[model samples]
Target: MKRYLAYYNENHCENRNYDVVIVGAGIGGLYTSLMLPKNLKIAVLSKKDIYDSDSCMAQGGIAASIQDDNRKLHVEDTINAGCYVNNLEAVNTLVDESEEAIESLIKLGVNFDRDLKGNFYRSFEGNHSIPRILHVNGDSTGKGIMDALIKEVKNAPNIEVIPNVFALDIIEEDNKCNGIVAYYKDKFVYFKSRQCVMASGGIGQLFSKTTNADILTGDGIAMAIRANVELDNMEYIQFHPTAFYSQDFDNKLFLISEAVRGEGAMLRNSSGKRFMKKYDNRMELAPRDIVARAISHEIDKSNSNCVYLDATMYNRDFLKNRFNKIYSECKNNGLQIEKDYIPVIPAEHYFMGGIKVDLYSRTNMTNLYAVGECACTGVHGANRLASNSLIEAVVFGKRAAGDISKRINYDFEDNISTINTRNNPPNKGRQEFDVDFLKLRIDLKKLMDSSVGIIRNIDKLQNALNFVDEVLFKIENLKFNSVLDAEVYNMYLVARSIIESILNTKDSIGSNYVEEYSRHSVV
Candidate 1:
């Protein structure tokens, strides 16, 4: 793994120092930076734009225990959805602070939808006993939250948002993290900081069909793995039950939010026969794992590529207003939500496993933290409950910011000006980059989708592991020059690790692969 590290010279590198270096610019990173004391210099690096994050793609809104909702129910629902494998302390922390997380977002000018009475227009989603999911502008909660946060980030004096900077590795010395090795304009940019945060989203792009952004290639996760950070539940990958099915598998699939079914949509086979009754008594509102498996079963039995989401019971005007994003997407594809059943199939949607972290979002390593989808904070166990990802991001982000603040003056800042660690700097590795990354990525996605999709057997897992070995062998001599090359390597590392974790898990079941508690670490 050391042979594959990002290269740099102690003398030729351009060193940029900050009080704190955040490796991602998603909701978690942005909120963490904004929450930090304004007197501190903060730098937020984005692989693409700050807007390009899984947090920014969330449409179903954040979950919180407000009003009639109780923290007990929220925690239970989360634990239940996670197959009771969640860390009790982390679950309690998320639910106990859920309201505060929502309030913080609102205070930051996130205009959640409200009725004329000035009350929150809360909605329903899969697996929840009540309508606690809050949205903004009907179906654009993610963009809405990101818009407000981006505006706030722009307005903040001490926070610097650096776009198009790809974080390559974590810089550490004597088992303590120092900063990040990043790539900008084809040069090594060493970010010297007292603390570092990995809010760099999830490992979604490793699949053929996912709802994640193109830039989400698990860079942070790979970096953590390279740094020997303890990872948890890596086998528990959550596939959403409703991504709009498409023939063109190259692009990021459009996700049909679970809120659609929460709003009374029914699942039907291609023959127009309702199918949920055969899978679960809950029908259209089962947990994502159950629903995705049911859909896969139906697809297998019917010999079709997709099932239908029948939202026609609602009038066009109502659907247009409530799910305008989905409605417009269907319309663009020559389908009508009011007149036709929208074609949907389960796709790789979210990663439940990530860099293991405590309630404070601190990883096993010192002065390092991870939040958002990339952090396995024990909130979402084997399977995530709907609408929890966004709230979980901000809640843990706030905690990480507070913890960093407490430890800021606690740790000494970089002594010398230029990223000059007292220890010897990392040297460049010799390699080749003569292959086509585009083709490698496409083929890798195909293998992951086929082997580790909604259904998996031990045979498939072994084959996938073999494929990972083959890919690694082929790229063993490849040079890490371009961002695409870096991302491909990250994807390969994450893919291999996830497959290995799955294979390592005893008595594993279908898509909702659970692990033995022996693999988890609690702080």
Candidate 2:
């Protein structure tokens, strides 16, 4: 088989073989590269710039069971917040390895915030029994972690970082993935590897308003579905309830980290009343699903476009010092968070469901692994406890690399054959008439927002299913003029998959709710 790589800097295709091809150069991908065998030939692929990932924009911290925190209590809180449907094995893996992951981050030069007493300054979040979230770079925890990981990855040898490279589809040989078709610069190329890991993150861009970056177009979820991978709990998408709201659509729903509520911030409506108390005993610090549901209900009942997150009620000096990022962003957007009431709304943020993976980050298929937001290890279940996402990414990314290193070495196999491989015929790549997929994607997004989001009823879900089915048919036959077409095609696949998963579910749990059958028992 011939390998191809197209570079815009030089119009030449280079054929090569790598031991492992890791998709999406986010924190997970970066960490995976670092943990791989020192001699392994690894290629890190990305559709755009490497740093433009959902992980890089995370303003919150990583939740863990460090210090004297009780592991049993953390486990119970995670399971409870997951609506008791989380995979026990996956939860155990996360909680058991969390401390090690934190320690690893610290060793990698991630400076988590500490107090004057020289101890880790932890913060509380929704559904946690203890204050164990270790923050870094103040309100820029994601950037801090990503910065450290990226810097280390850049200095590492045997890792080929390929940015602006998009993995369109996986090439399967006899039910096993042999390689992948990647579009780089302006041409499609094939990359064969012994192992592949998908760390491509979530599909937040599908929504009109989200905190995700432009690259999070559901590529990982859509690619797995195309390869017939097992996906679980996709309907349990977590929408952060307190996204900063601005009139400009540029950054309309910037996420106000759950850490704020974890640190005693209040959620109030126009009546100046604390509404979360009416829903859950934990009040403003309840699980994200409960708080988001309450906020959505209030927004609908009051016929308002957004809600309010009152930070002024807290100590202004402390708030300013702690949340400088949020404070400055709000200030730049013409809102004084300390003096003026900051407008907020729920934004479709993280997807809890993805390619189902085991503790080793191995998917059902051979030689294929998934980590980070792209894989549903079942730790998040229906709703993810705040700050657990970052921790999960690093923990599993390390495990995936460790798992792969034990079996594979870093040398290229010269005698590899491609007799079983079949390539799409020339001129079959994408045509000009395939742009209708974009319009169809817009329709799906509107349908998802109106019907499949927040509170769901039988009628609306049925309507959403119908709309998605029609769109999926269009996507199946659609050609592509550009990568946007590819993105739309994948978006349709993910939306349909989420709809199908929702339909198969019999009971209301966490983010997935069907009012008429909410009480239905599967047994």
Candidate 3:
């Protein structure tokens, strides 16, 4: 591993340069940085603490066709789950490289759980035909993986992990990404880089309740929109069918991993009767889109806030051993997994649309790349298959790193000549009107949840778009002093994009269920 030297300029706001600047310190950013040539100077930025990412919140394991399953079957399952709208090349790339990604993680010291025979323990998830998902610490897969990757990152001399930094915008000149202007250490700073990787995760925070971490405010997608980069599939937002229902209605919801259902937990109505059989023949093993919609429909019909997931039939010891975190959370919340039914509801979970990128994770703009939830590689087209997100992050993250390394020294000086050197300062003025960000955030969440959520219609979509447009107008006029203000602005942009996308897409497919289109006609 070679190390590159870095120097700071006299101006405090300018010239903190790096060979590569990766926005968002989730699995994608961390894995990409680790995979990059160690000779290049890399900077990984996180809006909050590095560990406070959606990746760390993932309870289910990464999916891969590593055991009795084959890559072809995995690819077919992914495409089928995506309503056959997935980009074939990207799907192939993801499936073909999944084993390698898993192996790389192992080499980096990710301690995946193993059985008595020293074989990796694999579990099943919704929509998967085979038991291909791998876990760690029974169910704390994300935490285990992140702990290892974080340790590896800290030991890498060429990588710098900067926390409490907000990337405001991607700085582009002459149609090429030069770097980013971000708020760091209570001041705005320009980080010049040869390449920029946008791995800033998803937009789950826009909704009132989500499995995503609070830090996920669609920063990467919003920045890409600002940079005039291509975005796609914005209408496709995956709602997990079984997030724990709480009366507090907090933005961060605890996800009851789909593996629970895969392991024989049954979705039942308030009357303690099984319900999924009516929705789909696959029952609890149906794809996430179907399951989520079923739950939403059940709630609407029953006029109840949530349905129940009955896991009492499973052995208590097995339940505790396999889903210790979920069991403990339920116990702490006054619902024991072994004796009581866990209340569950559908909540916004994953975004399948974002800054559009090619198979190599290269965005439309030069010197820019995106991976993870922030990048639409078309691998998870209309809806994502369960447990595929973690593997997608590792696969595309490595591809982005590899592609960037190959093109790292491609006459950057010549390209620099085409860029205009201009210093854009951050807005420092306070607004005359006091905007209630909390109220606006709540309003936005309700608006999206009611209109553009699991089910959609033309009228509701239009109403949501109109509301978002009104908020965007106000956000543009307001001046911000903190990163929180910027986050609100970004949320407005992302929410607007999603509403607009739903309006533009005419057909119902996968998670995007438009009322105008017949389900049989599309699905």
lDDT, each prediction: 0.84, 0.80, 0.86
**lDDT per residue, candidate 2, 202-284, as tens digits?**
88877777788878888877877867778878888888888887668652367898888888878888666778877889988
Per-candidate TM equals 0.94, 0.93, 0.94
TM-score of predicted structure 2: 0.93
Q: Write the per-residue lDDT of candidate 3 for residues 409-454, one digit (tens) a residue.
A: 8456734432233543223442457888878888888888889888
Q: Give RMSD to native, each candidate.
A: 3.7, 3.8, 4.5
| Model 3 ranges with Cα > 4 A deviation | 1-12, 414-431, 520-523
Judged by whole-model lDDT over C-alpha atoms, candidate 2 comes out at 0.80
Q: Kindly give the number of clashing pairs for every candidate.
A: 2, 0, 0
Ranking by lDDT: 3, 1, 2
- In model 3, pairs of residues that clash are none
